[model samples]
Target: MKFNWEGVMPAVTTKFTKDDKLDLKMFQTNIKAQVDAGVHGIVLGGTLGEASTLLESEKRQLTKSTLEVVEGKIPVLMNIAEQSTKGAIYAAQQAQQDGASGLMILPPMRYKSGDRETVTYFKEVAKNTDLPIMIYNNPVDYKIEVTLDMFDEMLECKNIQAVKESTRDTTNITRIINKFGTRLKIMTGVDTIALESLLMGADGWVAGLVCAFPAETVAIYELQKAGRIKEAIEIYRWFLPLLELDINPKLVQNIKLAEVYTNIGTENVRAPRLPLFGDERKNVIQIIESSLKTRPTLPAYKNL
Candidate 1:
């Protein structure tokens, strides 16, 4: 089915066993929880899912698990992002076969040089798959940015249908909306800037923080769409600090910790991506505790 690339798309975490293996049951449970919380979509195998640490077979398992739970209630956007275009294409093909609704493609991370290489990388991947793709422009993690000029060039590819703008620059978002708004759907990936992006004409939000707090995130988007900017901002302020935590390199650890705190998912993550410890671990726990204390209660998961 063709899916609308709008509203809250959670960059979901891949839950793991204490032994660090993929825990399919936990993963599916999390997906169902998000759907129950009313998220518009689910992004499997994204940065937040620690895709780098997962094996090819594990990725397939995750795709299958997510599809089983989602069951077409909402769109399922698979993150087919890897260090090589070949791997990305392979993953995209696998996701499509497994019933993914669309693809969220990131630039090749290994080669971090010229714009020419980046442009070529996207072109090759787009050629390999028929799925509508959302360009994942996150410079901080990938060490490369899809500049405005490169964005324009990639738009020529028919399947390059959308962009998840994580640059945190309102001007860039504004520029893209002003220029290519007709050609592409621009969704803000950064949770903190989601309100600003929507106000400035972004189509939706693909957020990492939404995994831990789906109801709150959905509420924020619904409020904005209802023309309730003041109400949205109030909710945005309550979520800003927790959203900031999602951008940190230690996001996987922090998010899992929050999940544990909320009793939503396991805190286990695969290595060499270790869980936060010592003072850092303590601080994250405190943050989740504090946020829960002040966060507004959702009727569906009131105990959380």
Candidate 2:
């Protein structure tokens, strides 16, 4: 599968059974729903996917399972959040060997690296893999900004093709475009501002909330692309509250709860991250339930 580096690619959650095992069956079901809803691609093992908690073997298993489900219709990308250049390179190579279409590689985790070190890390990983890479430029949470100047350094690596623009500034989208032109595909990484980012000329969205509401997420992107701004805005306004859930520290729990309500997934997350309980659970459920009640009928977007 060729990586297009565009459109709504869900930073999907890794599903688990009560026993904390990989629930590949439920994973497949949710992925099938994403496919049925016409998503552009599937990204596995990211922040939402609990990449930190997953063992190397588990990540490989998730990648292989995802490839099986998506088949060849859409690309399945693995997220590389390793802390070392060697580990990142190994993870990149493993993803390639396991049949990942591309990679969403973060800068060195745990220990924050400065501009020079960060650029070197990304360049090193790109050198090791033939797969196209999306640099996760999430300075707010990750504490390392992959600046335009850094991108200048990375230009020689042809495989470093995209940026997951999670900087939370919509203007950064335009800045990226102005600086690089089509050299780097800019996919907006924040959920709450996704439509805003798309409207601002972002090439696509690396969405989080799409794990539960795939169709609505895809519809927002398609409608915006189709020039149906009025319709897209209406749906986006409805989706705003739910979209806010993706930014919280407890996002995995929040989104898995949304999935539970949507009947697409369970709330069984990995350990050290338990399912939401008490008022936290209730509050999240309130948002999910409220949104579900007035869930807008998606207009025909396929022909758009």
Candidate 3:
């Protein structure tokens, strides 16, 4: 099925219990809240969801719970990234069966490899399912960059459709738009450059901060879509500092804490990934609190 993918697809956080178990109830509540707030889609199992730390079972459960909450109201894109091609394909097929609208596949991690290896990896995974696939290009995390040429090659797969452009370079965004705008649906994965990406002809944004502030994120996109540039910039300036905080190494910790402070989701995160503590923790708290205090009044939630 060809789905029209667009707008503020949050790389949602997976809510965990205090002991770091997957908190399914909290996860459902969070997804329900985003759907109610009118986001275009929910992107579970992505970087912000802490997908790397989740087990295969947990990934399946998250997709199941998300399907229940969203109730077919909006599209769901599951991020299936693993060190092994087989694992990624397994996860993608499971998510597709569980009613996910599409799969966002990341390059295999843990081994430093060349472009041919990376292309082979994605091709293997793509062959496994008929679900629409979005190539997630985040070079910083995966240590592999899928260039424009590689993207063109992948487009021949037909089911390999959209792209989540996470690189912070607008030039690359322009290059992709210039080359493949007609063939692919490009979405900005970087929160800071989301507006610029949209202005440069990207179809939508896959934002991380939308987990904390969905209304504001949606407003920015809607305003831009309506050609209300001045108004969108005004909201963007107010929210940019909070978006900046998301680019830190301690992002998951900060985002979870912000969710807790906003009474949206739990502050719990799994280990190997720990909560922010001491001065580092304090600095994130201070920034979020300050943002909340200075946070511009979004139009009535009804107006949104």
Candidate 4:
């Protein structure tokens, strides 16, 4: 279960029952779909996974349960979005103990640290855990940019291996590669621009919409890796509208609704986040349904 930090790794949604309990059965079902579709890895408790709402025990349960379903077929990486350095370090240690293959960690949540502080927070967490880490450099949403200079400092930590590049600027992929070379791997965290990122030499995609469209998502990555550019674009163009859902504010709810239509998951979310409603719900459904009407038949490609 060594994490290569490459390929389509879903920022999978957390399934919930009617009473807002962990619906592990449904969670496993989605995991199986991802595995069967030939994904390279699985990322748990991410933004799309509703990481903010999950309890510590629930996160541990998710890691264990995802490992059970993947059965070591692919690496399962738990996300760490804690508000404190100590909390982040403890979460990282807990994930390793829970048998997670790796971790996708963010800079300190709820507090925007400077470049030096951000690097320190990540380095501290990296030192405390043996697990390989994919640093989530999502300044667009989180407001703390992990600049290339910060990364230069963080390279001291061997475990700080990969980056979940969500800056929305595709050129940053090339910038990271230029600055760090192979020392740090880059995975596209934004769904809409994933193919562009890959074409620019990103190692993998930490996807969100893949939770509902596993096969299509995997197809895009595999096709790209195989140098089937035309084929990959055909699928990506069809997938663009659906993939845009991941960038919205209610991404969790947006993706969950897509899951409901796709029959892979339910629309149940925790309190403070409800299912999509009114015109918003109608518009999203229109997009999902429209895409489903003409979903493309994927061309055969080797599962890399």
Candidate 5:
């Protein structure tokens, strides 16, 4: 299957039981919601999915459940953010065996390795797995950026075919196109600047807020591709406030709250993370409720 790294692929959050066990049933329920909403694909075990806090078994269960729910209707890409190169390779191979269509891999987390180490790490993992890979380059959040020079070293690994461009600087989207062209699929990883990235010719969006506002996200992308900027901006302006929730260290909690408000998923994130309370909770809830009160109607896509 040729995976077109276009449209919205929500890095779905991991719903947990109160005891912090992987709530596979609720997880499946959330995944089905994304598919039914017409998202191009759904990503599991992502940064928003709280991958850093999940155990190995929980991660596998999440991916397996995602594959079962999606049933090949769309690509089920899993996030692989292991701290070691060998660990990343092993996880990548295991995910392919588990039926994931692709992977969104980050640089060796917590290491802050130099360019040579980062390049070698990604190349090794890409070579070991047959599934397509999207290199996650979010220096703002993860503190590691997959620079274009590093990408030049990656041309040897053809499977490393996509980049989640979260540099937070919009021009990097253009920079990637100027240098690599179609060799890499550029997905706007940061939510707030997603519309801008799409206008700059981003191939797709590995979105966070889309988990809550899927229809709006897809509509903005469709309208933009159809050359309807004024229309897209109208929605983008409305969505910007909610989209701002996709950034920062507490994004998992913030996005999970969005899911709760939309009733697509629960906000039961695991430990080391807790539900928002008091002013923080009220502030986010206020924003989401206000947006819901005036949500935009989605126009039909060309094909549909």
Candidate 6:
């Protein structure tokens, strides 16, 4: 299948075994489920996938494995979030070499660069690659906003194909559209406001909680796109609680917790990250349980 920077694409979580190794089988299973559920694409090794802790070899393995299972049924987008421009270029080259469909590239990780530095870093990587790129801009957490002016400068780099708008501000969606029109394909990166962003004319979604509720995610996107706003909101209202998990700091744990119910992925994570326990665990599960009890059937859109 051909991939545009549009529709419902998931930033899937990286799965780990109880022994703390990459659970490639489970990872592929999760990606397969995403495609099977009609997601427009799959984004691997992103923040949800814990890119910082993954070994270079492991990341490549993920890219290779993801492409195989997806089998070109949908675009398999690999995330490159390295801290150095040189490092990012190398990762992009590796993905291109392995036949990845595209990449979701973050600004230089760790050390927050100012606007000039950020634009330069993105351009440097884009100059060296033929693969399409999605600029991952989450100013709220990354502390380095990829401002519209910086994007104006970034226009010189031809491979900068899309924007993952996760500033946690809905107005930015309209602002981008007003500024550039279709110059940049905009993907809603925040889960909580995904419906609003889609309604505001974002071209796609790079969602985290979709790992658990892939069908619902795709349904909401399709329903909204088809102009069945009322039906889409009906599902969105039921999904909002679980969707809220994606915006929090414990997102990895929270999402995996929801995944456990789906039984496609596990809750295990690397050190500095652990399973949710105590009140936190109970609180998230309670929300998931409450929602499950009243889970809505998909809106039955034939286009799906």
Whole-model lDDT per candidate: 0.83, 0.92, 0.84, 0.92, 0.87, 0.89
- What tens-digit string does per-residue lDDT give for candidate 1 at 178-211? 7886687888988778889988888899987788
TM-score of each: 0.94, 0.98, 0.96, 0.98, 0.96, 0.97
- Number of the candidate with higher lDDT, 3 or 5: 5
Q: Candidate 1 or 4, higher lDDT?
A: 4
Sort by TM-score, top down from the best: 2, 4, 6, 5, 3, 1
Candidate 6 is scored at a TM of 0.97
lDDT of 6 at 170: 92
- Per-prediction backbone clash count: 0, 0, 0, 0, 0, 0
Model 1 clashing residue pairs (backbone)? none
Candidate 3, number of clashes: 0
**lDDT of each residue in 217-290, candidate 4, tens digit only:** 98999998888899999999999999999999989999999999888999999989999899999999999999
Question: lDDT tens string, model 6, 169-278?
Answer: 99999999999989888999988899999999899999888999999999999999998999999999999999989878899999998999988899999998999999
Off by over 4 Å in 6: 1-3, 302-304
Select the stronger candidate by TM-score from 4 and 6: 4
Off by over 4 Å in 4: none
Candidate 2 RMSD to the real structure: 1.0
Write down the TM-score for model 2. 0.98
Greater TM-score among 1 and 4 belongs to: 4
Total residue pair clashes for candidate 5:
0
lDDT, residue 142, candidate 3: 71
